[model samples]
Target: MKFIDEYLSDIKDKGLYRELKFFNRPQSKYTSIGNKRMLLMASNNYLDLCNDDRLKDAAEKAIHTYGVGSGGSRLTTGSYELHDQLEKKIAIFKGTEAAILFNTGYMANIGTITAIADKEWIIFSDALNHASIIDGCRLSGAKIVVYKHCDMDDLQEKIKVYKGNKRFIVTDGVFSMDGDIAPLDKIVKLAKENNILTMVDDAHGTGVLGDNGTGCVEYFNLKGQVDIQLGTLSKALASEGGFVAGTKSLVTYLRHKARSFIYSTALSPAMIAVSLCSLDIVKNEKERRVKLLENSKWFQWELRKLGFNVLESNTVIIALVIGNAEKTIKLSEKLFEKGIFISAIRPPTVPEHTSRLRITLMSSHNREELKYVLDKLKEAGMELGII
Candidate 1:
């Protein structure tokens, strides 16, 4: 009851002990959480494809044909037909020479980043990158230099200062917490000028941006300029896995070398098959993206109109800054009682003194539901004096 217990007690005493919420139904804009239908603005299911009929059907067929699990690592008897097929489809969608799948998004980043670079190389990371990317850089055995979030000038200055012989630059295509798109075009230009390898973790950007959901690379029209495109099937794809899209040789290298892939079991057949079906839906259903954008636009405007501190958000992710940890927790509880499910994100998920109600939007949410959530958020803010 010394170090670990004392820290755990501090979290509870500060009213910051994180706990999971119960959802008793399928994922959607509005779902049953403990028998009460609640507006869901917390899930990472961006395109609302989790309940898409085609994806579910494809997964069912995969289960029947290929069974539930891959049973072994990809190199050790787990490279089933579905896994290969999913990788091929993803590569085609992302306009990459090839792609490789991992059991989770975390593994995809961790494995690929660590395997590709060596101790002699330096990794330039963004300050606001997701945890997976941060950990991946740490595992790479490369000298890491963190640039200011989305500040190209800072990046340029660092490139001038760093003394590494081989340089790798990495950033999230979209900042998850702040909900701002990375300047991929600018980043690419800088990386090219400095002769640095570029990689983007487009986990939140894919399926929600670019032409036909190709992600930030497509958005920037730098299809092959970046060295690697790291993404997750779990978010926009509405499946439960992750993959890396890159040159054919890079993928081949990862297949043999990435420890996470070499050591872990393969992703399930159903998930891979479902991802294939999900990507197809993304290609055809442009209207879903339109709807999602409309929701984000309207909500961002509404949050600002309501005088909430919403940062530069242009996607499904929105935030109402309630900087105090205790206040953010209280606001979240109030919203939950009002039948809205949101997450109270605090340090170190985000930086300290920036605790907030991290509201995420979905394609399934209609105008009225969005309005309802906005209204509740306003009322809760006023009552709690959070705004």
Candidate 2:
């Protein structure tokens, strides 16, 4: 406890201390934090389907039919009809021959990476990949090579020297912190030339990118070419699970060999139902994606016009880098006072002196809401001398 307190003090002194903030209701364009109703720019519910009636109806029906929980792992009695159905749907959605479900996106990454690679193999990972991917590579006992963020030349150079029995390349389709798209086309080309297996975690890209919301693989027309596609149900899909979509053989192998999937409890019926409904909505609703993209472009353009640096963001997520962690926190708090709720991302989550306001857009956010948030952001930026 004394060591923990010392560490806490160090974090606090460095301006990296974080505290949990509670929202009293379900995620939406607006959320109630304590007594204050704030514009929710920090949520990952890109499609705003978390509170959608269709998902709610499906969830209620599922609860009535399948009860509250999946009492065992997928290898055991927990493999319900809904679980199977969702996996099949996800496979189809991702343009893969088969799919396997994991309890969370974190488990999916960890399990799949460790299951496939080991001491004999080498893994080439992007420097800016999610923590889950980093942990997975560590657990795999493989030689982990990290290329500079989205630097294909660096990736190619590093991967060329590895003469291992097997080689794997892992990257995020969308970098979560920088809000930039990976050069996946070039990565795929390099992987193909080197006979390397490719895995993309399209957590933020699913239900938002590509034609028909299939994600970055489909967006770049590399659907069948990418060896493995991993995604989350929780972000844009408004659900609670993750899936690995690939060839039938790959799915079968992971189902049998992936420790996380074999040992972890299956996702609940309600969550599965929500993903099913969300997928259907995503497939049918093209307008939402269009509106969301348009909004993101407009917001970023306005921020740039106001002399704020919005670096290379072409998606629903945008980051306004404010340098110092203390200043970033101050800007976030100042904006919060004006009823906007952008999150301040600091060190460990991001590099030191590059702390920022991570602004995310939802399909449900309209022009009026965007204008109001932008106005507050300008005020906050000016007050902090960040613009």
lDDT for 43 in candidate 1 is 86
Q: Cα RMSD (Å) between model 2 and the true structure?
A: 0.8
Quote the lDDT for 227 in model 2: 96
User: What TM-score would each prediction reach against the true structure?
Assistant: 0.98, 0.99
Top of the candidates by TM-score: 2
Q: How many collisions between residues are there in candidate 2?
A: 0
Error of 1 at 63 (Å): 1.2
lDDT of every predicted structure (CA atoms): 0.88, 0.92
Q: Residue 116, candidate 1: how far off, in angstroms? A: 1.8
Poorest 10 consecutive residues by lDDT, candidate 2 = 156-165
- Top model by lDDT, which number? 2
Per-residue lDDT of candidate 1, residues 55-94 (tens digit): 8899899999988878888888888887888889999998
